[model samples]
Target: MGLRAVSFFAIAVVSILMFHLPYREVKTAATESLNQRQMLLAKQASFGIESFFKEQRNLLRHFAHSPAFLELSKVGKDVIQEEINDHREFVKAVTIYDKKGIIKYSYPNPEKVIGKDISSQAHVKKILREHKANVSDVFNAIQGFQAVALSEPMFEDGEFVGVVAFLIDFKHIAKTYIESIQVGDDGYAWVISRDGTELYCPVPGHTGANISETSAQFPSALAMAEEMQKGHSGTTTYQYNKIRSKITETITKHAAYYPVNVFDNLWSIAVATPESEIYSEYQSFYKKMIFATVVLFAVLIFFGYTIIKDFNLQKLNKELEKRVAFEMDKRQQQEKVMLQQARFYSMGETLNTIAHQWRQPLNIIGLCVQDIEDTYRHNEITEKYIAETVDKTMKSLELLSRTIDNFSTFYTPNEQLTELNLYSFTKQIVSLLQEQFESLNINLKFDEDGTLQIRKSVFFDAKVYPDVLKQIILSCLQNSREAVQKRLRSGEISKGEIRLGILRADAEFSIVIIDNGGGIKEEVLDKVFDQYFTTKSVSIGMGLGLYISRNILEEYMNGTLSIKNYKDGAMVTIKFKDSKES
Candidate 1:
């Protein structure tokens, strides 16, 4: 009887050990994974919010430097009204304050807020006293919406004049960026200011409330908020009573938080989900483990130790294989979603570029029609005048038609190749962009005058997709134009210059575009061709120009595109194998 009791006791001990060890390992692995996912979500959210604010600030800075805004009195209020009209999607209102912090001009029903004193406002005081730009915390605006002020100090002749403030709709931004974040079914993200004021929240009555005052019941939440306030990034677990559909229940949550620094103002973003939700899969596994352990013990007592050992080993191996397959499937699904998102973004950028390309031609068509009316009104309408107007109108319309064809062919694959003179093809693109660049006081120079000393005997013919090549050249010129314009705006150069030329070698020919805009930074020089990487403001660039240009050159034309810092700026070179070699 004693020997039988000892055997039973030893089997029970082994069963308990087996169950506890696997359960603990699974729990630890699950917790680590949940933490990593939460942290990644937090980081992504933080970056997006940071980028949004930076774009807004850059826009405000651009507005502040406008010639009309700088010389306010001479320009009249028409310019201000026009500016506001053009950016109504992002800006709620535009207000200009005098040195005394009294509103001197406002757009969209100016009488309501103009002449009002905002000198006492903290942000206004900072601008007045420091003569520096400031971004205000979210506040209730007289416009009857929660808003934030992005204010730039206006300076003229090295003297502070006043402030040009753009009121950005806070709720719109939250809705677009913060509210869109979802981590699991019940997870949500929230934002808090450095002062502990909730900037955004998913829960009712939580937004705009001070965290220190409202989170008294949740010590863990308060602690996490304190860490975020210090600009520390990490993950934590907390408990709070979540109210849903009139039902309240205490639930533990795992969260990851990160800080967003915008113009020296710090804000924290936290993404959290219930712990139960995170461990839902593991809960079923736990029950299965318990049941399996009981069965194994019964087998040990009845069928002997060898059968039990083999059964347990096989079960463990099968469980590991299942876990591996599940993880791989999940990872693949995530990759597919990311790829879809990238394609959508690229399409949106292409559409925007198309609109921009159409705008100038459309305006020219309108002007041509207006000219005929004006000539008739003056009683100067003659056969020659009518003929000239019709000619100009037809030319503009033809250009518009050609633009449509180019856009269509740009996206269509396997386009038939055409043999064309390389120099003439490049000169044509330069001519199209020359007038536009001249309007911005930028010189777009090609080797039209033979100043680059090209040999008359050099062969310049190459067979390629004409429309695709044109699109690539146009994108490069546009990038150079923007860079030159940036330098022009910063007063770094009195005149912006972009030079385009062709070079011939033994094995290949290259088209080189060099600009006097500042060179690319060393750190980001390599990433210039990376998708969605841009130094320019978001509204001005989507970082797809170079990326697409390089890809098309390589994939379609059997060519290459390369860029590096040249004398005073950047040089982009497009190379193709010599036509003779082909």
Candidate 2:
């Protein structure tokens, strides 16, 4: 009887603790979840606004340096009109101001404000003083709308000549990013400048009012505004009075605010909701928790015996998971080893190519030495002759040194992305293998197509892992050399030809290599890129070249490697998407 009484006492204590403990925890968790949600919304809104400002600033800066703008004549006015027409969604008007801040031209009603002076404006003064780009705070514009100005100083021959500016529609930006944000039924977003002037607000009268004056009635809001003005991001609770349907009421609100940094200005975005809305469902949640507590106690008592059984099963599962993880790690290590071995094999091939490159230079140096000796023995070695021979020998030695340096650069490991002109980069790779191809009587050529020729004026720059790209190109060329050599030995052709061409598209470009060694057999073509699948003798290759090259292109460079039968031979193309593609 005593043991039964003790068991009942323990159950009551556990039930009481679980019931009360969870209520506080659940309430705290609900508040934190709301805070986090609001903060995320604010951050997203700020990011969108900042991006818009940055893009506009860059556009203005680009326009400021254009040949038309530098002309500072009627041509500059025409250019401003073109910009406004092209970007009508965000650009309301464009104005060009002389170095003294007197408006020289304004689009879409230039006569109204053309002769006006704006040197008193903060952003205009900043441009004249600093000769730098500036993004202004929201202000009333002469076009009778709220807008922000992005201005850049224009320079001619290193001297500041004038300023080019764009007036962007602030309301349009807010509607797209901030006004569309809805945290809950009553939650809305607003933006304010660093000076506390409201840029966008759902509240009708609060849109353009400074928060310091409008928030006087709400002390908590004043305090929160102070924090926001300092560029601090956080969550807070405040109280403000609002009128709905002719009834005035004071309501508590929760808010999260974040800062948005544009060129030289700061803006704050706030997402706020009524406190009643945040806790509207809490009462129902508490009622459910009460029922859950009773059910949970009964479940605990019934499942006490099964807990030990499940614990052992969990232990077994954990052990199996560990074993699987270990095996995966081991397999990854083995792949690394295989990759390294493939690199070493490629290095050996590069070394052989280097030897081919050095042979001519070495021969030239040897002939120079022999000429010097013969000249000296013949008593005809004048100062001029000795100097010429020494100069010739030095040139050959320099050539040999340059060959080693190029090879060293190719083998060096560089994992960082580098911007390179594809035309020049490919030319470098072709130069490396040209000698090796010539030694085998294979003609390797690099050419540019019509698209590439057109693109040359604006140079095709690609971000790539240069060393890895060089290695892959060399491997592809080596394969072509071997194929052509086979044809040469069989007397199928007097000269073997391989062409590497640059092909450009609207949003991407390709490096295409074509060889006339007879295409791969249709049956084995599909398996060419598979690991360890080689048509060459085992002594010559381990069949990892194409496989590894494809993997690197896909995984490291975000590119594609493809092969197809073309004409009498095979065409291999390495393609990368243009980074500038939007």
Candidate 3:
């Protein structure tokens, strides 16, 4: 009992865990979905920031081909000043430089920048080296304001004349790009350079500072910077104290970063949201899911206990039923054997009485016929008639005496297995009932399927119980008799027929009895030999005849008896092994 209780407890724990498995999966999937959604939003914010910087660079490319910047010597100073005035909100100053990176033109005070060489700037160096448009990262520049320079090459008739450059203010870019976007409750966006410098930050004083190495000595910041340098995009989690929780302690934050590539320069944009804000909604639901799983597990364990007990009781009941049914079957078979033996004994006594009563009278009749023949000797025709009459009388008496002896053998024990004369044995068996069949207008015959060399004297050694063979034939013919009688009453057949055929194969003898009677039902054909299985009236059948006959043939004879439907009736076949000649 102790072990059983332990097992039950273990199963209960497993069942509860199984019931909770789906919710655990659901929680995991929900977290993944949140992560993907945050990543998607961060990507969009990054794309927006890159688009803003790209727009300024595109404006510089367009201005480079404005005819004034391309041919600055011919164009008036007012055209350049008017263009700078138009972009004054985001642009700090505009300048045009010659191929040598010297400032040949300027907007907002050209005299201060024209003679001085400003070609040492990275954006100018890129434009001179590549002869293409370029944008620089955030830096302190000619405008005395932190900015990114957008420069494009200007050409006159496919010959590079100079470059048009626009210096856009960093404060303006961040205000438009990063400050407007939002993530989760504690989420914000920022822009950084490949060197891990915070070029744009939501915090007021954090710009231009590097956070690549954490204070806790973790390398998360350095790893992110490396990813940015490689131009890769993905999600990361790091210990971040900048976005503080309610306790004002350090906590983890999930961040998604994407590279911004506009005008052949790289920057990284990132969105960070606190972990607490990500899963706050599912916390209560998780508790309820656990409670439901526990309740379901308890109910299943209770049902298992009750069902196991009930199953044991039912199994015991079935065993008891089997024992009772077995006893009843044994008793029924014993009663059937007893009844059969008693009937045989009664039949033998009746045959003996008939022989005693009829033998003297039959002999006396033969003697009287002899006297009449002697009286008619003088007339030849009369003598011939008397002789024939006497001969037939003697033959008839002898046949009757032999039939009586044959009937007496029905109960006689011939248990020693011996050879049987197929022809003579079958003739005697049929002769016992031949007169009865004839009185009922039934015809009996024998046909052969295979050739017998000495056809008149076919014989078989008994591998079967000979008396039992007689019983099987007797039972079958009796059954056939009843079937034919039923059909006659129903007008189904005008005359009844029973055929006994003998066949010889390689090493077997087959005795086939075919009768014109009601064929057996297909449904019960296999079960007809089972004890107490029958389809006749209870008064007329004990249902043991075929069952006993089958046992006798199978057990004592080492032979087989089978029945099949043939024509309008059933054909019973008995096959004995070893049909060796005697």
TM-score leader = 1
- Pick the winner on lDDT between candidates 2 and 3: 2
Which regions of candidate 3 fall more than 4 Å away from where they truly are?
15-20, 73-76, 142-144, 213-216, 242-248, 289-582
The candidate with the higher TM-score, 2 or 3, is 2
True lDDT of residue 344, candidate 3:
55
Clashing pairs in 2: none
Top-lDDT structure, candidate number: 2
lDDT (0 to 1) per candidate: 0.76, 0.78, 0.68
Query: Compared with the true structure, what per-residue lDDT tens digits does model 2 show for residues 26-54?
Result: 55666778999999789767866776777
**Tell me, what's the RMSD of every candidate?**
25.0, 22.3, 40.0
Query: For candidate 3, lDDT tens digit of each residue in 1-582?
Result: 456557556756765554455445545555565667667655655655666766777777777777756667546467667767887888778888888988887878778889667678777777798898877878977557788888888888898888888778888877755676576667787778877778877776668777563333546656766787677888887666654355556677777878887757778887777777776765665675566556545554554465466766666545644553454355345444644553454355345445544666587777767767776575545767667766767876786776667666755778766676765676666655665676577876656445454564644433445676777777777777777777777798899888887676756778888887877777777777654467852211224466656766776666787887887888888877752322
- The residue-by-residue lDDT of candidate 1 on 1-582, one tens digit each, is 356447656756765665566556656666777788778667766766676777767877776777777666646467667767887766888889989999988887888888899999999998899988878999988768889888988877778888888888888778766787786799889999999999999888988899988889999999999999999999989999988798999999988898988786888889888988877866765776567557555644543333345656666645644553454355345445644553454355455555556788788889988987898899999999888888887888887788778657545554577776777768766755666677688888986446444552346776777777777777777778778888899898999889998876765778888888887778778787764467773212334467667766886778999888887888888988754467
Clashing pairs for predicted structure model 1, backbone only: none
Worst 10 residues of 3 by lDDT: 536-545
